[model samples]
Target: MTLNRPDVFGSISLMFWSIVIVVCIKYLGFITRADNDGEGGILALAHLTRSSLREGSRRYALVMILGVIGASLFYGDSLLTPSISVLSAVEGIEVAIPSLSHVVLELGVLIIVGLFVVQRHGTEKVGKSFGPIMIVWFVTLAAMGLTHIAEDPSILAALSPHYGMLFIAEHPFIAFVASGAIVLVITGTEALYADMGHLGRPAIATAWFGLVFPALTLNYLGQGAMILNHPETVSNPFFKMAPDWGQIPLVLLSTMATVIASQAVISGVYSVSRQAERLGYLPRLTVRQTSAHTGGQIYVPAVNWLVFAGVLALMLTFGESSRLATAYGVAVTATFILTTVLFCVYASSALGWKPWQVLLAGGLFGVIELAFFAANVTKVFHGGWLPILVALLLSTVMLTWQRGVVLVTARRTKLEGPLTEYLSSDAVVNVKRIPGSAVFLHPSKQTVPLALRENVHFNQVLHNNVVIVTTRSLNVPHVDDSERVTIDHLASEYDRITHVQLDYGFSDHQDVPAGLKVAAERHGVELDIENATYFISRITLRISDRPGMARWRKGIVRGLAQNAARPSDYFHLPIDRTVLMGAEVNF
Candidate 1:
């Protein structure tokens, strides 16, 4: 930013106003109110809005696309944030010990690597210390900034709307450019909403207003005051604010805080990926529950490694935090803009807001976010293109996986026909019955299980008791254990066939065997837990080079299906008792 030599007053004004408008108002005021059950985030909000709309409607598809795009943008932010935050903090070594500056990049990369490696073990152990560390960190920031504020008391005047308006009015172009950097102050504001399910709105609000908001304000103000006294220090005012002795400790503290900060986003990436799989926008990956007591405590090795690789590439290519800064605001602002648009959809579809009311709220928020987005647009040519490219690639992958599921499901349904029609057919009634129970996992109870049909087609012997289990993920956060799972006695014919439908919210943990046990107990079915063989149809997708998608897309979609984790592991089934039936599908 010093390269541009923009006015300090304009930059400072824009910075404070951004925190107030974007963080304090736009998110807290409107966005967080539209959570899906107790969960809140762009993906959760997308599910909430879609839940209100009729299935197969245009609005539902539109909301799903926007949700997927918002999630992809989050992936971009997750990659860029850790690199920039850690690098920026490590650069403070130059302030504490000028001679040690040469090792800053190496140290930054090392710290980031350590951060990623510990991710698989999960945050359960160190997470207890995070609260205390951040509390001390924020208090230190406030104390540091409060002492410096006495140096130039006038810096407080930037808080007024007048200064912000005047700065924008007098220097429109510079204020526009300043907004791109000012956005750095509010980078993690979305976390407030994303984590609402974990902490709840009341706790998040209490922490934000009672501690975070004040601490951040004081620290940024102190930096402004220090820069006011010595304008030459504008290059890195944050580190320059501390005295010689305090600089080293501050640098160490900053590094720790940045690591903690990066951990939050990495955890967010894991959560969004889980939701994507649950909603069928992605293939089921290996989800290891890091905490046995906490259902949401999950870690994905694939997502972790991919994110680390992306972060490393970003650090190496950008070389400095300043260059990476140009890439930051684009993804954050784009996500914010989309969230605002999605909220408007929710306000109308769910809340039944009038047109004027929606316009007054959403239009105001949209125009502000659009301005921030436009300011960020000026940076695309200046190394800001990375996140955009990342987002595009992710969006393509998500769309491909989603489209592939539809095609595969359609093909299967057409081949097997409905469950009712098939069960009532002459062949099922007279087929030779074998011993032991066979449980088949299917997507829908109304559709015939491909594994069952194929099993009977080849072997020509049906199990004496064949149980078809269809698991569904709903749009809310959790499902009560008692309401949904049931064994369809009437649907069962020849006293050997039964249908079990298990329903869960997207955020719920799914255990097929456990659910079946409950269903079996309630229905008075004599079930042997270990003796039952769980069957799953393993699909090998081929490139049909269909009309809807290009040949390359078809190949990519096929690769995703072929590489996905096996259904047994994904669903937490007993490995020894599971049987997978393979089939080829060219679509």
Candidate 2:
């Protein structure tokens, strides 16, 4: 009876079309073209868009804000994806053994905790098998789907455009409402786009269209066939398609696939966090490179534990996969909308697209994304509030931190720039020029290091030759070694004072000593890595009572600063030799 209704058909139509509209067109067709030198994410997109405009322009600032919000919201979704994906599969146990349904949540939490615990060790070893494992999972899914499709081969008609069009035309209001539920199929589409940088566009596109898309098509159509044959199975047609004896193995296989998917999502969280750090949206964390051969593979312990805590809370609070699903589409929909907006800007500016071209692509995708976004908004009170709340909170922190950094830089900018006089013999007069080189890690090359100024003001001692170094994260993912370090002068590099600017890709690690050593070797500058004294500044944040963010957020900025990884640790400066000069900053 339900299958005869246009509304039922419309829902399926909307679901299938969304995958084509959002995932296939918006991501694969357009957004993937916006990758920044093999690095992909909201931040990369923002930086790429920023590169097309004049530095310090308002439009640049606007794009940066969108990226920050998207990245923050992504943080919220990353936790949910793993929890929901794993829990939903584990829940298949209920279909296998209805009596064991009670243990699903407990087992899901246990698996999630285990996943988080092993994050510290890095996935370089286990990661190699991911592609093969996923291939097997997908093949298994296709085979299972094939078993049921034979029962009602006519169900394949759902893939035809005429059915979708007729259903939407016959049931307009129901089609509109069904858009929300239908969007669930395309939830991870943005993540696929985000990871395309490392994996490359061709590989990602191949995987999506080649194996994944076909497998998904077969599985959904097969489920549709099963539901049509036995309408009672509509409640859980996915598991219902499998016979009683095969249900247990299906559950086992589903759990394995979900766990693998969840692990990849967790790795994405860490990867995005590092990108945020390099792009200056967040404070630095302790970054550990997992593999010696690959510089990109990294682990952040804090992020791992925080994500674990969030997943744990969601597990206890929602307690059901269905409830978690209610919260899923909101963050993802918002991100898609932002990605489309940003891609429009990038296409118009850098991709050399005409206004009409931008409008055509953006308008089409924007309407679909906005419709889904609005539909998801209706679910806010019903578990959808969690991610929205997390996004707002995280965005506030990012914006506040950025604002605080701005105020600090503004204050220092007026007073500090390259002190040619400080580098001169006159300023160095009576200053005890100590032995060995002193590397001053500064935020800006133009700004005189407060540590350099303070070292002279207090002890009145400076290293024989001073190196004022500032590291810049480029829009791209990897900066070539040839162009990695840029020095101020020519040969011997001004024996008394030299300004060094090191360029790194967002995915590159921040290693002050390594960058310095490489620069020294290339330039023939004298340097002893062991004895070099690294100078860094520690800011004491003070609320200005100034017209800025709310008082609560200023406090959060302070907390972030307090909890941020120490400069010595983050920059890999030798602990015993690193000198921290404390400075007070007001925001």
Candidate 3:
């Protein structure tokens, strides 16, 4: 009966599966990295934590602590993964020619430098070429694996539920540890979800299930076959599977792919940093335009230089892929687990699903993720300290920036009276009339910012029309221009306002004044950008011995603020029309 069955079914099934693999491969990596401000990675996860939970809620505090911790660990993963991915591929060269080992490290460094230098060109041009190159890479992997699979048909047995189950049963601890190593195969898979807004969910899902999964599975199985067939070659099964002549091209391709992975992460850092600044967790940094079309395609000079330095340090110190592997999984796995938890919360609150329903559905996924996380944690005593150290340093900086901004804002607000009080007071009423509308730019929603109060005491004169401009961001990117800016009347003469924020996906520049003008016109306000005066309060922070945070943290906070970009420039306020009220404030 089996022999009489048509071969057409098998042919059609193979064709269907092939299509699925191709689609998955195209978008899997990109999807895993998408997040706020057109960036994805640990920092994006941190932003998610702050944005999702209420400040006063117990869940907010808990999620914040957990998110930061997870984000810090993700930094570790970012540092180590490049080294592993590149070195493992380069090491394949050693199989073809043993003498290349002495020079491989130098080659690796060259590849990393070249990768970062080209980032200014924007990923769109390079990314277009990536799909084709990845196609070749996957095809090569599949071909190599197929050749070996022919030798021992039983090697396919590993795909069976029984082999995996039996392997775990026999050596649970070893299997757990091995799972960490294997998980590297799907390292950037989450980018598929994070980048959903960029590539769209259907594209990413199709890419993973179709092309990427099959190619990766084939390559991994080929490596497994090499290990099983020649037990002595277990030291580096990937290299053993490659033919002598194919090793050089494989090495080059692998190095290229690793560089691509690092580029994704570094770009992610820039996006997340900008988002954090907007969310009030980070100080604004000078974000330089890298591309004209993509608002998300920005180059943060400070972050870029810092990441380049860190990558170099990591390459120099680790020197080998095996050693770097120790640090790879811990951070990213932790982030994955944290994301699941956050997603559960988001599903419940934002999606308006039943709490029990979300908990049940998300909880299953969480359990599997945590198991993987635990495996990564087991690797901590090894060279994992590398990523942990990097993450801790980053988290410290993030937390300090957040705390310092809060304290400084609070101190500034203390000096100002309520809007109703200020408008009714003799001080505002007695002021000389000015020609145009006077807009006061305050940092918070409270009565008066301390910097504004200092400026008011010195200037003493109020303008004819008073407008307090406050900018707000929605969780999603790219709001309609009509909804971008909203003006609400708070009291008789007092106005409360908000803005609809728009960000182009990671490849365009943001023009705040132009955007505001467009939005205002759409909302029926004749905004005269040419004649309007923009007022900004510049706070100069003074270091004090007042007890608040650790001395080191205080120093870090001061340095971050000092190095931050001036608000006028960051917000794209017109230099020709803007005036700064500089005042010294204590934190």
User: Best candidate, TM-score-wise?
Assistant: 1
Model 2 CA deviation exceeding 4 Å by range: 5-10, 53-60, 291-297, 415-417, 435-437, 472-495, 500-524, 545-551
Ranking by TM-score: 1, 2, 3
Residue 585 lDDT in candidate 1: 71
The C-alpha stretches of model 1 lying farther than 4 A from their native spots are 1-10, 53-58, 123-126, 290-297, 472-485, 490-493, 502-509, 514-522
Task: Give lDDT tens digits, candidate 2, residues 150-220.
Answer: 98787666776677878767767666677787887888876776665335688779988999988987888
lDDT of each: 0.81, 0.79, 0.61
- C-alpha TM-score for every candidate: 0.92, 0.90, 0.79
Best by lDDT: 1
Residue runs of model 3 more than 4 Å from their true location after superposition: 1-57, 190-198, 228-235, 287-299, 340-378, 434-440, 443-456, 462-468, 473-533, 543-552, 574-577
**Clash number for candidate 1:** 0
Writing each residue's lDDT as its tens digit, candidate 1 over 1-587 gives 35221245556667777788788888887787877656667888899999999999999999989999998988999999899999999999988898998898899999999999988786565567677888888999998889888887877876766777787887788777777777788888776677665456777678888998899889888887777778788788888787888999999999999998898788778777877887788887887766544445568899999999999998988888988887788988999988988988998989999999999888777787888889899889987788888989999999888987888777767776788778777778778988788898987778787788888889888888788888886655567778658667535544667878888765566888888787777765555666999999877676775567777877878888777887887677999899888777767
Candidate 3 lowest-lDDT run of ten: 1-10
Comparison by TM-score, 2 against 3, better one: 2
Candidate no. 3 TM-score: 0.79
Q: Deviation in angstroms for 409 in model 1?
A: 0.9
lDDT of 3 by residue, 499-552 (tens): 233333233234556665764567544345567777777777877776676767
